[model samples]
Target: MMKINQHILDFAKVFIAINLCLVIYSFAFESMHWLLNTQVAFFSSLFITIASFLSYKRNIQSRISNLDMSKTSKTEDRDKIDEIDDPYDLYTEYEEIPEEELTPEKIKEIINDEKSKVRKDSFKNTLFSAGGFLSIYRVLGYGSLLFGFFALNNNGIFLPIAFMIGLGVVPLGVLASKLLFKKL
Candidate 1:
């Protein structure tokens, strides 16, 4: 699990490196020349912003895959526990025992334990999904905002268009997230 997490961290670092390079390239070359026309600047910024968002999505997917691998191991451990000899097993020697054989408190404890596990798992899954959504939103939001600023400073014509498109990112992202959540 640690190894998987380390690999995910490394992957994230690589993404950061690539994003940095893109940022430098945009500022040094593309931003300077592409800002001549409002339409061109708006479109260019939109394209780059989408590309950055896709890159972030890929990074998140890699991390999720790693997490899923770790979760599989945990499920295996649970399966092992289920297989172990226990009085609760239907095929065990204690199968003939009456319902009253187990104390009421013990039965309640078992039920509570199962309920807790379910609640914990649900919480974890919800948190993971929410975190992923927020991360994507942040990446898209900031990228679009920055691109809009560059477009506005370079070409007056594209300023309104760029800003409008940039503002649209949040709603688009929210819609996409909702669709994704529904599909999941």
Candidate 2:
């Protein structure tokens, strides 16, 4: 399952890379050159980069939100009476069972069971989310790099600007990876 997820994430990263390249090529050769000023190229590239990042964030948020446990809880009918009535009766019947009746061995067993469950759940979620964010960050980082290349190549007048933007991407990528790791 994790491998499959990683594969899917890899595909997404590649797709984003291709899309970014296309955007850069189009901006450099097709549309903005006719606009006269290099500002048009700069702003157009900036807008595309920002829009892509926003869309990526939106996609991640939407996916995570859909997977939220709160939504499942909200749809569940806790007020349903008859379904729980028998369990209530059984609990009442067992009410006389003393707390001291639970042996240390049984308590230890239950604690271990709960701990194992928690660990498994944590591992699964971490793996899945890490895969997701790894893919996302890769896409964003590479896309930004590609855009920087385009900006540098087409607008020699804005070379310093493009250089700074390109150089800035490295730290941004690191920060993003760190944050994503923490989240996972």
Candidate 3:
């Protein structure tokens, strides 16, 4: 469950990155005459970078708080349901001792049982998501690349420059996200 939420969060990160690129592209090239300079472009890029970083940080903190809450509740429930008092209640009441006393064979069996216990929290996340989010960036990049070629063919100036901005803006956005959120 934790891993699934993380992947969903990653998708959100990529989604924000792609949108930031689009915003920067439009602001630098498709804006008014006063905003036609590269200064406005860089400013917009910086604004988008900081904004996305704040949002991603907020999201990660929220998820971690929720996970902590769930963890505490589970431990509380386990303690309340255990119908044991003191002394012999050393282990949980759910455990079944195999032998009468703690003989060498019994100790071995206990160790083996512990080793084979099913720990849901110990599972590892796979090195993939439901779908790769990079494909969206690729499509965005290719579309801008094509537009760039067309803009170069015509007497256009902003479109070609905007295409270059769009090409590299996703990486910049991603780097900002990582730097601020401290995650990939």
Candidate 4:
């Protein structure tokens, strides 16, 4: 059997639990419209969150695999827990160049190269990368949210409060999941 991802299982549990509560509320209130509106928003947000999560996970995996083995080995002696929690070190040491090599032209060239790299990395992270904000899945996700909201509202089936609650489900679920999964 193929192994299922634990994060996805957590999300599924969240989805089911929220909807089950809503179902009970719907039954008591006898308001199917509220249930429908909430479901649409909840499902759309959950879909988007899952897609972005998968994209981010893929990006991180690739980054890890592409890291220089020598650098990884140097950090291997540190606490294993810290490495697992944060693989990327936020502070990197800078190498110093001798004053003799710091000519105006050389300085200009170095600055330009750094600028270009920054621009390239920023552009890639903002749009071209799988986990970027403008990536296909993200775009689709927002589009679905907007269209779903308008569709339900236009049909006179929307409950603003219920829809808002539904939209909040993912963040709440994520928080709850983290708490549930936190290390002792």
Q: Could you say which candidate leads in TM-score? A: 4
Q: How close is candidate 4 to the true structure, as a TM-score?
A: 0.68
TM-score, one value per model: 0.30, 0.33, 0.28, 0.68
- lDDT for 154 (candidate 3): 64
**Native-referenced Cα lDDT, model 3:** 0.49
Q: Please report, in order, the local distance difference test score of every candidate based on alpha carbons.
A: 0.52, 0.51, 0.49, 0.78
| Tens digit per residue, CA lDDT, model 3, 1-184 | 3455664366457646666556666576566321233333443444444455555565556546655444334354456445244222345447566566779987899788876654423331111221222234434444544554554446444544644554445566566656666754
Question: Residue by residue across 1-184, what tens digits does model 2's lDDT show?
Answer: 3355553354344434444554575577655433223333333444445455555676678667767555433224444463355423333222354788889988899799999999998997776556444565556655755665566567753344334543443334445445554433
Error of 3 at 177 (Å): 1.5
Instruction: Please report the TM-score between candidate 2 and the true structure.
Output: 0.33
* Candidate 1: segments with Cα more than 4 A from true spot: 1-60, 67-98, 136-184
Ten contiguous residues with the weakest lDDT in model 2: 86-95
RMSD of 2: 13.9
Q: What is the lDDT of candidate 1?
A: 0.52
Candidate numbers sorted by TM-score from highest down:
4, 2, 1, 3
Off by over 4 Å in 4: 62-113, 124-131
Candidate 1 residues 1-184, lDDT tens each?
3355453344344444444454465577655433333334344444555455666676678656766444334343345555554323344332354677678887898789999999998997776556545565556656665675675566654445434543444345445445544432
Better of 3 and 4 by TM-score: 4
Indicate the residue-level lDDT of 168 in model 3. 48
Clashes of 1: 1
